[model samples]
Target chain A: MIKLEIKLMKNILGANDEIAALNRKLFAERGVVVMNLMGSPGSGKTTLLEKTLVRLVDKIKIAVIEGDLFTAKDAERIERAGVEVIQINTAGGCHLDAAMIQKACTSLDLNAIDLLIVENVGNLVCPAEFDIGENFKAVVLSITEGDDKPLKYPLIFKESEVTLLNKIDLLPFTNFDLRSAREDLITLHPTIKIFETSCTGGTGLEDWCTWLLQKVAR
Target chain B: MHEATLAENILNIALEAAKQNQAAKIFKIGLTLGEMAGVEVEALTLSFDVLKKNTPADGAELAIKRVPISAVCNKCGKIFQLESYNFFCPACDGILILQSGRELLVDFVDCE
Candidate 1:
C-alpha cells in the first residue's frame, strides 16, 4: 500500500461559517440587524420575543423566523402579534444550520425589515455551536432553570453577547440565587450584559427594548 | 445530537482532500477537538462509523485529539491552562481571556 499524507488543516465549522458569511453580507446589503435568540425549552424565549414585538413593532420594521422541532405553535403566536413571521420546523433536527436560514430568507422581504430575529431551536448546547449569521447571539435563561446554568452550559453563556434572565417574577417562588448567577456569568464572560426580565410582569422589558433599539440603530 | 452532522462535514472534507490529492482511497483522518467544543468524542466516533460507509472515506480511522482550555490573563498577561471551568488566572488571579479550547478542525488525512 502506498502512503500519502495531506495536511488539510480545515476547520470543522468552515462550511457553516461560509454560509453564515453569505447571510451576513445579504443582511448588511438589506440594512437589517439580525439577532439569534437561543435558550433551553420553556426558557420563555417565545414570550420574550412577543414582548419585544409589542414594544418595537411600531418603531422598527421587524421580522421573525421561529425554529422548532415539530409544531408551528410559536410561529402562530408570533403571527397574532402581527409582524411578518416564518416558521422553520426542524422536524427532528436539534439545531438550525446556516443552510436552513438561507432557505428561510428566500421567503422574507429583507428590504422591508429593520430587524430580523431568528429564534433558534430551544437548545442551549447545539445552537451555540452553529452560527446562523446573526449580528450577535442572545440567550434567555429563566430563573427557574437555576443559577448553576451559567457554569453548566458555559459555551452558550460564553458565546452569547447578552443573557436575559427571564421569569424574574418567579424568583421568590424558586430557590434561584440571582447574585450567584451574576457572579458566575461574570467569571464565564467578563463583559457580558445581563438583563433581568419577567415577561408577564413587564419587569425589565423597557430596558431590554431600549437596548435592542439602540443595537438596531447602530 | 449534532455529532452526526459534524461527522458528515468531516467526511466531506476528507473526500475533497483525497480528490484534490488524486488519491484512490482514504486511510485516516485526524481531528482536533477543543475541550470546550461541547462535542462528545464517543458520539462523534459512532457517528463517523455509521456515516462513513459508501463514501470515499469508508473504513477510514478517525483520530481525535482533545486540547485543554487555555487562556491569557488580561491584567498581568500570563498564559495558563485551565483545569476547571473557572477562568481565573492562576498567577495574578485576574480575569482570564480565553486563548484556545473552542477549536474543531480536520487536521490531516492519510490516503493512497
Candidate 2:
C-alpha cells in the first residue's frame, strides 16, 4: 500500500476563529460592542446583567444573548428587565461557539443597538477557550468562591480583559481574601481591569456602568 | 462535553487536508495540546473515537503531544519552563510573562 503524508499545521480552532472574525466584522459594521460574560454557576452573571440593564436601558439601546444548558429562565429575567433578549439552549454543550453567535447575530436588530452582551453558559473553563466574537471577555468570580480560583483557573483569568469580583456584600461573611485575588490577577495579567460589585447592595454599579458605557461609545 | 466538539473540529481539519492533498484515507493525526489548554486528553480521545465513524479518518490513529507552559521573565529577561503553576521566574524570582501554554493545533496528518 502506498502512503502519502500531508503536513498540515492547521489549528483545530481555525474554523471557529474564522467564524469569529466574521462575527467581529459584522459587529463593527453594525456599530455594536459585544461583551462575552463568563463565570461559574451562581456567580451572579445574570443578576449583574440585570443590574446593568436596569441602569443603562434608558440611556442606551441594548440587547442580550443568554446562553444556558436548558430553560429560558435567564432570558425571561432579562426580558423582565425590558431589553430585547435571545436565549440559546446549548442542550448539554458546555460552551458557545462562534457559529452560535453568528446565527444569533442575524436575529438581533444590530442597527438599533449600541451594546450586545452575550452571557456565556455559566462555565469558567470551556467558555474561555472559545471566542464568540466579543470585543473582550469579562469573567465574573464571586467573592464566596475564594481567592485561589485565579491560580486554579489561570486560563480564564489570563484570557479575560476584565474581572468582576461579584458578591462583595457577602465578603464579610465568607473567608474570601480580596487582596490575594487582586494580587493573583495582577500576576496572571498585568493590566487586567477589575471591578468590585455587589448586585444586591448596588455598591459599584455606577462605576461598572460608566466603564461599560465608555466601551460602547468607543 | 466540549471535547466532542473539539474532536469534530479535528476530524474536519484532517478530512479537509486529506481532500486537498487528494489522499485516499487518513492513517494518523498528530495534535499539539498545551498544558494549560484546559482540555482533557482522554475525553478528547474518546470523543474522537466515537465521531470518526464512516468518515475518511474512520480508523486513524491520533497522537497527541502535550506542551508544558513556559514563560519569559520580564524583569530578568530569562526564559524558563514552568513545571508548576507558579508564574515566578526560576532565576530571579520575578513575575514571568507567559510565553506558551494556550495552544491547540493539528500538527500533521498521514494519509494514503
Candidate 3:
C-alpha cells in the first residue's frame, strides 16, 4: 500500500459565494436594490417590514421574499400590507443561502420592482454566516433582548452594514443600556449605520425609510 | 446548527479531490477553523464522521487546526491576540483591525 498525500487549499464556502456574486450581478442589472433583514426570533422583523412597505410602496415599487423555518406566517403579514411577496420555507434549516435566493427570484418580475427586501430566517448566529446576495445587510436588535447582545454575537453586528435598534418605545420599561450597545457596535464596525426604530408608534420609521431610499437611489 | 451543511460540503470537496487525483481511498481530511468563523468544532466533527460513511472517505480522520483571533492596531501598529470579542487596542486605545481570524477552509487531503 502506498501513502498518497494531496495538497489542496480551498474555501468551503466557495460555491455559495459564487452564486451570491451571480445574484448580485443580476440585481444590479435589473436596477433593484436588495436588503437582507436579519434578527432574533421575536425581533419585530415582520412589523418593521410592514411599516417600511406602508411608507415606501407609493414612492417606489417594492417586493419581498420571506424566509422561515416552517410556515408562511410572515409572508401572510407582508401580503396584508399590500405588496408582492414570495415565501421560502427552509424546512428546519437555520439560514438562507445564496442558491435559495437565486431560485426564488425566478418567479418575480425583477424589472417592475425597485427594491427587494429578503427577510432572513430568525437566527442571530447562523444567518450571519450566509450571504444571500443582498446589497446590504441590516440586523434588527430589539431593546428588550439585552444590551449585551452586541458583544455576545459580534459577528452578526459586524457583518451588518446597518442596525435597527427596534422597540425604542419600550426602552423606559426595560433595563437596556443604549450607550454601551452603541459603543460596542461602533467598536466592532466603525462605519455601520445605526437607526433607532419603533414600529408601534412609527417613531423612527421615517428616518430608516429615508436612508433606505437614499441607498436605492445611489 | 449549520455545521451539518459545512461538513457535507467538506466531504464532497474531499471526495471530488480524491477522485480527481485518481486515489482509491481517503484516509484523512484536514481543516483550518478560526476563532471567529462561528463554527462549533465538536458538532462539525460529529457531522463529518456521520456523513463520510459509505464513501471513499469512510472512517477518515478529521484533523482540524484551530487558529486564534488576532488584530493589528491602527494607531500603535502593534499586533495582539484578542479574546472574549474585545477589539479595543491595548496599546493606544485604537480600534484593532482584524488580521488573521475568520478562516474556514479545507487545507489538504491524505489518501492512497
Question: lDDT, candidate 3, residue B50?
Answer: 95
Q: What digit string (tens of lDDT, one per residue) describes model 3 on residues A75-159?
A: 9999998899999999999999999999999999999999999999998998888877899999999999999998889889988
lDDT (0 to 1) per candidate: 0.93, 0.91, 0.92
The regions of model 3 sitting more than 4 angstroms off are: B73-79, B87-95
Residue range A2-66, candidate 2, lDDT tens digits: 69877777888988999999999999999999999999999999999999999999999999999
How high is each candidate's TM-score?
Answer: 0.95, 0.92, 0.95
Poorly placed runs, candidate 1 (over 4 Å): B88-94
Rank ordering of all candidates by DockQ, starting from the highest:
1, 3, 2
For all the predictions, what are the DockQ values? Answer: 0.77, 0.66, 0.70
DockQ of 3: 0.70
As a whole number from 0 to 100, the lDDT of residue A183 in candidate 1 is: 90
Question: Which stretches in model 2 have alpha-carbon errors above 4 Å?
Answer: B72-78, B84-97
Candidate 1 displacement at residue A33 in angstroms: 0.9
Worst 10 residues of 2 chain A by lDDT: A1-10
lDDT of 3 by residue, B13-111 (tens): 999999999898999999998888889899998999899889999979999998999999888999998876667787786878888778889999999
